[model samples]
Target: MTRTVLVTGGSSGIGRAIAERFAADQAEVFITGRTPDTVERTAKELGVHGVACDAGDPGQVTALTARLDGLDVLVNAAGGLSQATSDDGSNLDALLAQWHAHLEQNLLTAVLTTASVQDRLTSGSSVISIGSIGAERRGGSYGAAKAALGAWNASLSAELAPKGVTCNVISAGFIDGTNFFHGQLSNERRRTLVEETHNKRSGTVDDIAQTAHFLASPGARHITGQTLHVNGGAFTTR
Candidate 1:
């Protein structure tokens, strides 16, 4: 039987890579993005369905969920940190605004999307949330939100495990390709990041995409509520 998959923020970056992976496997793939043009262009290029929806907004998420049914995989990949996304990040009020924006963009997006599509998921479905290594180190507001994501995933796993659904988070490291850094990464910083990794090389979007694919496969059914770190040993765990 053909599987049905949904990936949010799939117009570019890691999300796009994950969508392409699913499409290549001959699954019925659906991707969503905040912009119509990019979503349409990506859908046309990848031969998959695309919808214009801001996953961070509750109403848009509701609409997007309504369009999905019998979903086998839900990849929550819509999240990012913009320096100017909120009030100034220095002042107290600005700090509050920044924190709220990060939580809304990173945490709330996945929560709202999964809650809306809970019933539509099949028995063996998988929910993969994209996370960041910042959660384990000094990422500030974004890190805090990602840490909360891991916390939430643990609870979600408990609630879904009995129903045979697996939920997990992928804590990605300094992945090089794509528009993630938005062209602000300097050569010095790039070298510093590469040096921090044990592999002495930057990561690629396909690395995370491949891991997401494995988590959704039958072999990963026994794995739930786990945070799989993919940072090339930049940070080690006990």
Candidate 2:
């Protein structure tokens, strides 16, 4: 039987790749983004349903999930680094803004979206959140939020495991493509990131996409409440 999948922030980058992976497998896929044009454009390109939504906003998340009947897979891929700024002239306020933005984008997006859609997840459903290697390193505020994501996933997995629904977090690192770096990475920085990895290479969007596909597959039914690192061994967890 065909499964239904939902991916947030699916207009481009890693999220789009995950949506495409599911669609290629004959799954009924729906994706959401904050912008109408971008979401519609991507849906047209991929032949999947797209909804305009800011997943961090409870109201938008509610409306987005209300459009779903039920889902076999839910991929919470919405997140980003906020701009560092002192635009408000208060240095402390600017710092707080950045931290709050990271928490909302990286952690709360997954939490709120999951809560909104829990009733729609059928048995054997899988909920996957996109985390970051930053959580283990010098990502600062963003890192803290991703770390909280792992903690939340642990709890969510425990709550859902008995129901045959699994929850996992894929903590990615040094991805080459996508707007993650916003085209501002220097060549030296790129080399440094790659060299930090055991594989001596940066990650691609497909790496995360394929992982999501498997986590939602029957093969991964026994795996939940875990953060599977996908950074080419950049950061190892015992």
Candidate 3:
């Protein structure tokens, strides 16, 4: 049977790849983005349904999930680093803005989306949130938010597991096709990132996509409340 899959931030990058993976499997996929044109274009290109919704906004999330009949999988891929502020500004205010933006984009987006769809998630449903290696190694507000996402996933998994719903976080590292670097990744930085990986290569979108597909599959029914690191052994977890 075809499954209903919802992916936020499906307009591009890892989210787009994940949506394509599901569509290739003939799943009924629904993608959302904050922009109408981007979401519509992506949905049309991928032959999936598109909705314009900001995952950071509670009301938009509520309305978005209300349109769903039910969900087999929900992928919270709607997050990223915020734009850096000018150093010319007051350090304290700039830091505060950055922190607030990071929390809203990385943490609150997933939290609000999951909360909105919690009731719609039936037994056997899977909830996957995208995390980052930054959460483990880097020191920044964005990393902190991603860390919070993992913590929240642990609790959410415990809450949903009893009802047969599984929740997990995929902590990705140095993915190639995303706007993660925001065009600031110099050749030296790129080489450094690759050298740090055991495989000596940057991660592809397919890596995360396939992992998500597996987590939502029947084989992974027993896995819940876990953060699966997919960073080419760049960061190991005990």
> What RMSD, rounded to one decimal, does every model reach?
1.4, 1.8, 1.5
- Candidate 1 C-alpha lDDT tens digits along 18-58: 99999999999999998899999999999999999988888
TM-score of 3: 0.97
lDDT of 3 at 194: 91
User: How big is the RMSD of model 3?
Assistant: 1.5
Clash statistics: count for each candidate: 0, 0, 0
Local distance difference test, candidate 2 = 0.93
Evaluate model 2: give its TM-score: 0.97
TM-scores, all models, native as reference? 0.96, 0.97, 0.97
Q: What is the lDDT of residue 224 in candidate 3?
A: 99
- Cα error, candidate 2, residue 232 (Å): 0.8
Rank order (by lDDT, best first): 2, 3, 1
Residues 1-238 of candidate 2: C-alpha lDDT, one tens digit per residue:
9899999999899999999999999899999999999999999999999999999999999988889888899999999887776334468888888888989999999999999999998779999999999999987888999999999999999999998899999999999779987778999999999999998999999999999999999999999999999999889988
Worst 10 residues of 2 by lDDT: 81-90
Backbone clash total for model 3 is 0
Tell me how far the alpha carbon of residue 136 in candidate 1 is from the true structure, in angstroms, after superposition.
0.8
